[model samples]
Target: MENGTNTQSEGKDPSGFLSKIIGNPVMVKLNSGVVYKGKYFTRELQSVDGYMNIALEKTEEYVDGTKRRSYGDAFVRGNNVMYISADS
Candidate 1:
């Protein structure tokens, strides 16, 4: 078990899974339940100093399954983010 763990860690890229999705279109959901879609730009696998920076080409603020507003070309701070996934 110990050997397996070590081997897995050694083969893993330090940049992690996020590296595969950089510069791709992604959908980010914030803790407030707001969703944003845009081209991802961050290279860091994890948030930097507890903050994830994202560039948004589109944004949707949701309330009760409805979009309250929409916009384009915005920057989002990480603290509000809940999760991010590659957009199809």
Candidate 2:
């Protein structure tokens, strides 16, 4: 490319969707059937990465729909994450 510039078409990006949900409540489920409900993604998240690794504040853990415990801040590895749902 001539002046170090080029143009190409790419697909839709999900980063915008992720960014929009910052400071909102969400429920995150892990592959092990554990669920974590908390305030979702933000600067303190530490690493909301490509694998979906998550960090949260004011987190509550749930097991089989039963509240188990709470954490002031929580970190979960992305590999175990099943899905993340935003609160309505």
Candidate with the greatest lDDT versus the true structure: 2
CA lDDT, every prediction?
0.64, 0.80
Query: Mind giving the per-residue lDDT tens digits that candidate 2 earns over 1-88?
Result: 2477543421133355567688899888999999999996578554676777788889999999999999999988889998888876
Clashing pairs for model 2 are none
- Clashes (candidate 2): 0
Q: What is the lDDT of residue 81 in candidate 1?
A: 84
Listed per model in order, the count of residue pairs whose N, CA or C atoms clash below 3 Å is 1, 0
The alpha-carbon deviation from the true structure for residue 32 of candidate 2, after best TM-score superposition, in angstroms, is: 0.9
lDDT of 1: 0.64
TM-score of 2: 0.78
| Backbone clashes in model 1, listed as residue pairs | 52-78
What tens-digit string does per-residue lDDT give for candidate 1 at 1-88?
2654565554344244456786677778889877777765454334433356666554555565677777766677877888877887
